[model samples]
Target: MDMHILQALKSETRTGNFVGIATANLSSRSELIAQLCEIAGTGRLQPGLRILTDYVGASHYLLARADLLQEAGLDFVVSSDWPFDLVTNLAEAFVGGFGRATELEKCMQLFQPHFAVLPETADVPDGASRQYCSLMFNIGRSRLALMFLFDDGFILSQERLRDVGLLTAYYTSLLQYSGTTTDRDFELTDRELECLFWIAEGKTSDEIAMILGISRNTINNYITSVMRKTATKTRSEAIAFAVRNNLV
Candidate 1:
């Protein structure tokens, strides 16, 4: 099944429509690797595995940041149609069964290679039950799960799975950045970021002005400028957006 997939990929590449083949003029392995590499780029998540899944036969994929688990106070699950019930149940277990330290340790330990079938009790979605292989691996600061619901006979390689892990981490990290309160380059100014931090901490413009030794009017102007630049409205909404995008 794996070889067949690769053959299909090669054939598709020749046809000139394959997503992974657009830059096939890549002359060397390093060039190929760079083209396929999404880890170091900036975004909420990398698109490498997502693109791979599309090129292959998988319907959907998910990559969760292990480090985010600490700040979010929850285990992150990235998969397609993984039942909300299943996610809630497993998240409860993750919360109860492991401490922050333990979870981090587990993520670190799995960095090389790992994959598995979800337990029978796991309430996988109807769409996912046929092929029904939910596998996980860790890479750098994140953990990822790739669940495929294609034909039962379909098989993916260990090497490919490792690539999925690496690619997923890259995507997830990039996505994490996209959702962060800070932008990748230039970043918000010190004053702007200071205001944002305070807003997230529940400070009002008047309070921020007092803290920054500026007048309330000046603080309001700064906030208005921030809203325009960030393209957000309402302080609370802005803060939420910042936090979600990893801007803060």
Candidate 2:
């Protein structure tokens, strides 16, 4: 199916409102991934890129090069325990809270970004951390995150972040069409993926229930269904599977 860009971008605002976009027609999926790898290596994008996918029957991810992040005193979270501490912490500490489903849309509507900040924290050791900024976003079954390490006096404004997020979504949509995030069988229903998405975001069962307007037990059932389907033993392992497989 072909996705209309303006229409989709117009709607990247909240869950249950996402519109499907067409795959990349300009570049091969490999070429695009390689390009991002080069960007990650160059430190132009900062600590790294984490591309998470939740689709078909699996969840998975691909991290940008590690050497680049090493220079910044950071590393990708271990897949099994990918705490994603950096994302949660950055949102809370710097931006007050993670912005809306459509962060940019909300900003445009309200005339203020959900979270925009200066990259001038004094706690960054040796100024390594100050150069970089982080944000996360979603498009369909995929979640895209990029951290940009900018020159002094430069900031990753909310508008720019949203732009990057959309671009990242474009690239990952290509990956999805190219079958890059799939390997084997693990059938998760739509309900299961919804539960997994919120779980990966650090939402508790009760919180997810409230957000989805479902009962707490129903949320738990969805999660347990995910774990069983994915052959995971614990909630974290199930989420880890989701992350690595790009299911969430």
Candidate 3:
């Protein structure tokens, strides 16, 4: 199934108003990695690709395999309690379709990433000056995140980013049909989901209690349950998770 997806991707990555290929020239997944290498002028390819379940801080991923990026401490992202303040507070428009990060200087402030541990093959330039592009696809109740890395020399045009995002969404649906999706969501009760939905809409516990015809204490309890199940540290974090995962 992955091969078939890759084969389809070969023809899907071309970016143009109908003319040229992007800098990545991403004919295949390997080519995508090679493009990163080419952009960095590294002459060697050690790339990382993590297709996440959400564009935000995600605990679970659909697929994770990146030997190249693990050098920079990216491998620890899922287990770490690192805060993604920007992703949690992203505009609704960004999450609804496709979006790219790091191209616009102002938006870089949203995501927090520690420096990459430089690989043994030091072909690329300084890690501090590297360019990272994360492509996100919002599919129904599911979201897909693809993270790309290269040096500052790479010119990431918006058109190329959009093409990558669209092609990635294509593979996301294929993965779904092939049953590559696993550990989708922690089991949240109906009451917990209801509470999360209301909370996302700016409802307080007392308001949710009145709306659900339940006691405020019960409303709080349900929220607590949601927090516990989602492994979120705070109510705000839990709500962010709900919104990112389309649970609300």
Candidate 4:
């Protein structure tokens, strides 16, 4: 994570919705906050995430970057306590489903909790639910999701789940502030990102071409390729997607 991004998040924290978590009546919320504070002091991310998983009544947790889901391997995973075989079996299907979602849909899903059913072939832990909960949030330019599997027949509190999402973002910010955030391998090329930056600045293909000394058709091709790779439908949506993920 970049310092400027962390600084921006620090400023936002002063006015962000997380400030209201303290006033919530849930005892788990308080415990979550206390544990997070302690983790902040100790600088251990996994323990904090484990605390969040327990606080939410989840049997297992997996935190990952949403944007990097298309990549090979489990490189996108930030932290996880899920069974290794389950993750291996599900990663491909997860990436495919994530890619099918439009950029607009992905943007709209930020900080919103959703549920999905695990594949029947997955080797789940005993008594864990087939249904899993996921919540997405942005930490600077990164779009991260926290997905967890709860016990069978245990009802999840929606409020606590939302609080967990917010706290996960806060926990990631703590990692950023301590310079322990994991390095990311972006999928976009240098030229692709350069084109994205220009388009985000409201430049037309021709104008960008003039600035970059490329032909208008080539510039259009770059923008189109960006849209395809990003799973966006149009130039505007592509720019919006780039901005949300901090690609520019």
Candidate 5:
């Protein structure tokens, strides 16, 4: 939220896509942790997982905690509308294989800065499968993979995928930040969180006020309060902080 960064985002916001990358890069670890806390604090993993789906534009997404996989297989799909049988049949093997294999680990270390495209092959169910998936590896106890399904021929830039990976790390941190935002006692009023959400979407205070049927000053106050609670400085910093932390 430095004044210089705020000015930069303001200037870039006018340019659209470039600004998203800039803004996303400027997000802070603390704010990202705060959002993760909010997600983890939900108690239910599904909602937090859904945030990843939305953030990455995936039709289906899953986060199977490595150690929790049952003797039979992965306990839950984590997040998705992916076919049930598809998940049930292949979930355990993939988790187990991913567990035994060191490739997943080495991939995390070496291939991290690069995005991975997983082929729809034997492991993934044919009926529920797509032509391509972009995976960002996340390690937590066991191997955790963040998979993004895209239509055929969809291409993502390396730098953009790196951004996705960084954001995914924050997404994983929500589970890691279990004590804070995840605490049942840790709460930000609905209105306050809502304001933060929209601001992250790049809405102006006036736009948010109009959307919420509140005055501009009230809208600004809500944002200011969010910054105070989240310990962020400027609005750009606040939003960047939110993005990095997966707050929105």
Candidate 6:
């Protein structure tokens, strides 16, 4: 639901409240939580994600930072078991579609799963569905998406999909609590971080200039300074660096 509840769930996960909750509310799904706990205990994110993918009968999974999707690169992708060529071909379109949604729309759709069809030109794995599903959730300030590609003719259960979505949030909470997720301190100034944030949201220098009420040239200067300080050769790279380090 809201960030507060998600944060509390994460805290509960860290403090070993899972068993109690599972017994009280997840009687039928206690096995799922137990499996998640085992995976979380191992401190391996890929296995946890893979387990969720299988739980929903999905053929593949792609976990990404939804906020960074607007940036023009795969840097937003946190982990994926999808085919590389397919990912490369669909990445821009997926990110662009996400960027087009309004903030209110995004907020209303959090943890709600939706599906889209793959283009005819795209190469999909044999026996896989042309349609794919995606669910979004937040961990603190970061918004993450979990995408799934299932087999052809297979009907994904709505109830199971919701369970997978909530379980994913729990799995990530454990990872964050166990220090498996990345955390870095950077030297960028507040202005620089602000510039980087807009850029990652797919803003141009001119657009950011208008939004921040500064000259376009000043915005460009801020971005250039960010690139230099971050040792990134381009604006996209700088934004990618910021996203990977969770600076934005």
Q: What clash count goes with each model?
A: 23, 13, 3, 0, 7, 0
Model 3 per-residue lDDT tens digits across residues 1-248: 10111112223322221122233333444454454444333211111222221112122122211111112222212121112432232212223222233334323422222122222333322322222344444444343345543333322334444545564455444433433222546487677888887775557899999999999999988988888888887666775565445454
**Which stretches of candidate 6 lie above 4 Å from their native place?**
1-28, 41-43, 173-186, 204-222
> Candidate 1, TM-score vs. the true structure?
0.44
Tens digits of per-residue lDDT for model 6, 1-248:
10111211211211112112121222235667778877777878899887777666566899988877644568788889888888887787787788789999999888887778777778987756678889999977678899887656554466667888998997887666555333234467788889888897778898999999999999999899889887899876887787656666
Worst 10 residues of 3 by lDDT: 1-10
- Candidate with more favorable, higher TM-score: 2 or 4: 4
Per-model TM-score, in order, reads 0.44, 0.43, 0.38, 0.63, 0.42, 0.73
The C-alpha stretches of model 2 lying farther than 4 A from their native spots are 1-95, 99-138, 141-145, 153-166, 180-184, 187-191, 194-219, 229-237
In candidate 1, what are the lDDT values of residues 1-248, reduced to their tens digit? 21222222222222122122232221232433575563445442334554555443444454443333332323244333434655554554443433444655565655343333445567554334232334456443234555543333343344444555555555555556444333431445778877876776557788999999999998888778777777777775666555555554
Specify the highest-TM-score model's number: 6
Task: List residue ranges in candidate 5 displaced over 4 A.
Answer: 1-48, 67-71, 103-129, 132-143, 179-248
Candidate 2 vs 3: which has more TM-score? 2
Alpha-carbon shift of residue 218 in model 3 (angstroms): 3.0
Q: Tell me which of candidates 3 and 6 scores higher on TM-score.
A: 6
Model 4 misplaced regions, further than 4 Å: 1-27, 180-248
- Candidate 3 vs 4: which has more lDDT: 4
Candidate 6 residue 238 Cα shift, in angstroms, is 1.7
Per-residue alpha-carbon lDDT of model 2 for 46-65, expressed as tens digits?
22233212110001222321
- Clashing pairs for model 5 are 27-240, 32-245, 36-174, 37-181, 37-182, 38-181, 41-182
lDDT of each: 0.49, 0.44, 0.41, 0.70, 0.50, 0.74
Ranking by TM-score: 6, 4, 1, 2, 5, 3
Q: Name the better of 2 and 5 by lDDT.
A: 5
If the candidates were sorted by their lDDT against the true structure, best first, what order would they fall in?
6, 4, 5, 1, 2, 3
